[model samples]
Target: MKSLFSVSVLIPVLSISMIFNSWAQNPDFPWPEGKRMALSLSFDDARASNPDPGAALLDEYGVKATFYVVPSGMESDIAAWKEVVASGHEIGNHSLYHPCSGNFVWSRNKALEDYTLERMRSELSAANEEVERLLGVRPEVFAYPCGLTYVGKGERTQSYVPLIAEMFLSGRGWKDEAPVDPYYADMAQLTGMEMDNKSFEEILPLIEAAAENRQWLVLAGHETRTEGNQTTYLSMLRKLAAYANDPANGIWIAPVGEVAKYVKEKRAEMEGNLNIPGISRPAEGETIYLTAEKGKGIGPDIKYMPEWNAFGWFTAEDRVEWDLDLPEKGKYEVWMEWSVSDEEAGKPFVLTSGEQTLEGIVKPSGSWETFQKTKIGELALEEDFNRIIVASGEDFDEGALMDLKALTLVPVGK
Candidate 1:
């Protein structure tokens, strides 16, 4: 039997160390065997057309794509879906009843606005169980139904993204505007660009741009019919497979899970090998300050407060990152300057450098204005460039993570 998925075979001549060092200074990701970019073709809803001409066309070119299936929709096409699995394609969970916003009249009966976190979790778990029982493969990835991720309306609204992050290897969103930056992307919410109803000519530009930037492009669609609403035309798929398979085009195409796994493994490899000596810190090590103004905040709720020279309005989903190039490899004692209300003092946060992470609990400084400096923990530094991230821990709930002023990294023993 063929493998469930395929990955680009790395060339034996290029050592992993050599590849990491070469791309250490360059911004572009080092694709396997020097491919310019990566692409993943995925279809949602598991429409009958997907297993017929869609998977068939892909198999002809030795391409493996991802199929996010609604388990309830798979009853009529079990045989064809088994063939899809046999041909090395991926099967992902697309929920059970395909709940969407109540705005869509057809889905009003199964609307997300009426759901609670517990109910959504039950449905997702049931869907996984059904899919596994039917297809003999438990899905490792997921797709948000109708691109909607929340479970309620207004103040009651709760994002189920964290749930997906905990349950699957990755979760993909629909109708996203850009390709994923492997370096900074949140794996749980990968961007899925639409390929439905687009001609090959229309899609070529997106592929070309991704190539230039060495990014990962995930193309999503519904059916595989030649002409229909929400359909990924067979003609376009043929041309795309041909273009990607051509070595001259410099594209590495694979299933979504395969590409995501590769990106994670490569990042781990790169971070693991950063201990090699190349630069030197001064005899008297310097204290590196990552001020709030200098840090880049990601996610919806984190904000910079110029009045306090700090970042405030933090939530569990928010993260603050700082890019640095350490002059030497050594242990650095980490310290955080922040303030939080007494009620929010127990929230936990983690500081990560490469593979090492230092976890600390938020200290109560009485009020947000009264900042306190506390030594969190120490982490070993890498000589090369590193992205330091401070993120909320699993235990965080309704309270704010903290109002951060700055993070300091002082050399432990200079």
Candidate 2:
């Protein structure tokens, strides 16, 4: 007779297989050839080491990486840089003069804290023009100087992220903890993880995690050498390239701009296939309702309850998201129709769209069947396509959060 432990293990194994099959069929971002995730290798500062052995090693492995260059730094290595471009690598702007915060003693004279938005804008444009003139290919992506993105200081400080968003197809930051979510990440501020001075063993876990989440991993380094400070080891890179090249690993490795362009195209396709009516500008005094049936449910536990016309079985990990296309920017009052038993009350949840977020605690509605409408807060949304997500907060315990019926948005001062 089969052992009881064997039977128990068999059930979960079959369940996991089914889940994987379902995901393979309908992924959030359709990667080419059913690849699990994307990887982008990028280097910054236009280091001389990049063109010598860095690009050569990558060429041997059939890998394309992005090199963010300061035009002034490349003047001495023009021929090698040209060969890099001809070899099919991408070039991105790293800004002229490479301004950073005054906190760094070296950058004190060219500090961003002393610059105005107009001055910063002019510098960025000049860098792009110079790069195009020198390289024959316009830099379409950017990496923030020292990963800092602000002008001025104190209350007068303003972020230059908007400037980057307007100028480049994608802008990258350094020392980020996690990978980019292909569906939700802001193209202007993609996270760039550090790969310098790390061994293959140290970076394997990150690659595995990104593959598990089907996210995009953009690894950034300064130099590519055998062994040194702030360097990506050639040995480590060789191992990584071999691992990614194998068909079993299922990774799509390419340059930053290439992966960014593919993500944009895929996102547009997903939005067009949503099939739900787009949210447009309502007449004055009208409210927009996002119903449960219209919203997309993510995670394994969240499910729709047709009888109650709501989404139920919500766990801490579950999320409900909606897409909206607004004609103009406006401030709106936010409300929610939800139901939860007394035992599950006080569970916190957060609703977020763009950079705006509204946090609220779940109120007991006597029973899950009894729905109550409550005004949560107000938010100012930007014009164009916006993705809104409602997810459980950190305080959420082990239980159902709420049965969400609909979300309401009323234009403020309408």
Candidate 3:
């Protein structure tokens, strides 16, 4: 049985239009491959231990994580750090000088209390530039140094969060209580759950909580050790890796940039669906436009919907092929728009992206004159070009099942 994970039910106070059909699934919540939630392990400060045995351990588990580093920390052992980057671990800007509150005493000399927002911005920019110069990857994600976001003192204090958002795809806050809600999480200040000084036993609850609601769980850590003050236990890391790698657990483990990109694309697609006016913009990922006699590689012998523009007369052997390019790999929600006749209402059809296949039902829309939009299912799309094929099901008869219209692929977040 499918569980409809509920998030607070509200007793409607205002009058709702009866005309509006409450959609069964939430398009806004983009969980891919039926995953329960997302998990991203992010380490802060470029300690020697991080790129050393730490990267090796992660590589062994086939797990990739984000390392937010101060360029200076890795400067002495730049080659080792480069190896970490080459191992598929993401490098995030943790600012040039790791500044913190003046109250810490250690940061009193170069405290945030004396610095301005402009100085912080410049520091972050320089950090990115230096990291890119050394590692050849410009970080699109950022983590606050010392988990602090403000600069200056008292009333003069200003948050550098806005500046970070302007520069990076995402910014993480440390020791946060909740996981990020893809529908509502501010990507600039993604909540970073505490994982430092934790055992796998202590971390499992956090993961379970996030999984319950399909939220994005970001584990924030400092060192990668077992006996240190702020160490994220290596044992815990291994266990987490094993859990995420198991398909039965239903967790999508990825780097910060990869997850952020998918969430952004999915959110944009949801917003576009709600945009009634001329405000909707183009969506990301694969989009095949096949309005009857139009689009690429669609055979010339096609039939159009009577008065509806798009073509019809789909045969069991006929298939539409579209070239799909994906920079950030994930699962995409496939949507099909077409007109259906009474006889074709129950016809079986299949949509595929590589090895991922989605079986869809042909729903009736009163008559073939009306074109309706419907969700087929989700399919995994990897990096680079994907040949998305659409054809009839094995049991489908070789006849005009439905009219050919358009199909869209939007990356779903997990």
Candidate 4:
């Protein structure tokens, strides 16, 4: 299985350590390894239709999937759940109660006090307890209940994921598109790309595309058999089975948890080093930090500040920029690290530029917020300069201010 992934790791090696331990984007992330492989299907909500009679379908066909389960809803089907585990499907925590609201709510004391984390862990633990009790195995993968996109925004309600659980499982269902950021252990977390009743015709094309691109795809579902016929899903499974089983196609099927495990293994091999020349040269044991300030609200934590953009509205007083430069023209992956606790009490910073942007929230806790890193984007270098500039995307009140830390640039060794 490790052999199939080598195609993805093609960047410069020895230089990785320098990238990881820097203040800019760690160029060492998304360690290039093995051929481009796409993760197969995944289902959310622990639907009743899972572990279909076609339990062996994915593995027999060489495909893998992650099943985000809400134990409260599927507690009665222990046998079916066991079969799913026995057959090699990955089970992930989707929150104990699947609270539709309060998805982004978090607290500094989550692991120690919040019910969300405690209940989530308990629910997942209990589910794992049940699985181990029945199937003799414990589950690890975890998916956000509502694809909650947290970027250091809002009050203490925002749940902060402790580092202790970082390696628990691959992160899943973060969004509905291909993930480009490697800041996360498993950034490929996607949504609704498959289900029991969806047509083979509808699902096959996406699978084919992901395989061709060596990308990961996630399919989400709710109450699959709880409401519809199983034939379409069965047929879709059969088709997927064929695609996964065909080694010539280069598709590796595993549960989301399994995929996360694989990523952890591979990343461990590279050991958190990014290898881009010139822009960022992170040495081993170094770290990068990025900050986001306030502006017009884009989502929750993200703001639409024009001061950072070259085109946005801002004068000298409303502007902030970075000091960095690219070496050559080619593909590049960029990441920015951010800490919410660093902002002034009750103050959140809005960071942005023509292409780079982020927002960080400062809490009243006074404790420095932990680091949350994010990949900015992959750029096609067209020129070179002494120092690249990163500024605020928009203007803010004169009283408002944005801070600076580090800017990293990586030349994608494409």
Which candidate's lDDT is highest?
A: 2
Instruction: For residues 101-202, write the lDDT of model 4, one tens digit per residue.
Output: 433365243322234444555555666666456556665766665665232333545442542155255555543655323333334343434354677687
The digit string of per-residue lDDT tens for model 1 on 1-414 reads: 532112222222212232111111223577989999999999999898999999999999999999999997889989899999999999999998999999999999999999999999999999999989998999999999889989999999999999999999899999999998776678899999999999999999999999988999999999998999999999999999999999998999999999989988877766522212122223336888777756766655666665677776455667767877766777887888999989777776667766666666676899977999878777777776777777775535466888988888888876
Clashing pairs in 1: none
The TM-score between candidate 4 and the true structure equals 0.50
Query: What's the best-to-worst order under lDDT?
Result: 2, 1, 3, 4
**Which stretches of model 1 miss by more than 4 angstroms?**
1-27, 272-414
User: How many residue pairs clash in all the candidates, one count each?
Assistant: 0, 0, 1, 74
Candidate 3 lDDT, 1-414, residue by residue in tens: 422111122232112232222111233366788888889999999987898678888999899999999998898899999999899999999989889998998989889999998888888889989999999999999998777889998899898889988999999999888999886678999999889888898999988988888889999998887668888889999999998999998899999899999999987765523211111122354353433322222332334332454545455544555565556567666677877878767776666655556665677867777878777666676666666655555444445667757776665653
Query: Tens digits of per-residue lDDT for model 2 on 335-393?
Result: 89999999988776777776566666787998988999988877777777777777775
Greater TM-score among 1 and 4 belongs to: 1
Per-candidate TM equals: 0.64, 0.70, 0.61, 0.50
The local lDDT score (0 to 100) that residue 111 gets in candidate 4 is: 27
Model 2: colliding residue pairs: none
Candidate with maximal TM-score: 2
Query: Candidate 4: what lDDT?
Result: 0.46
Supply the TM-score for candidate 1: 0.64
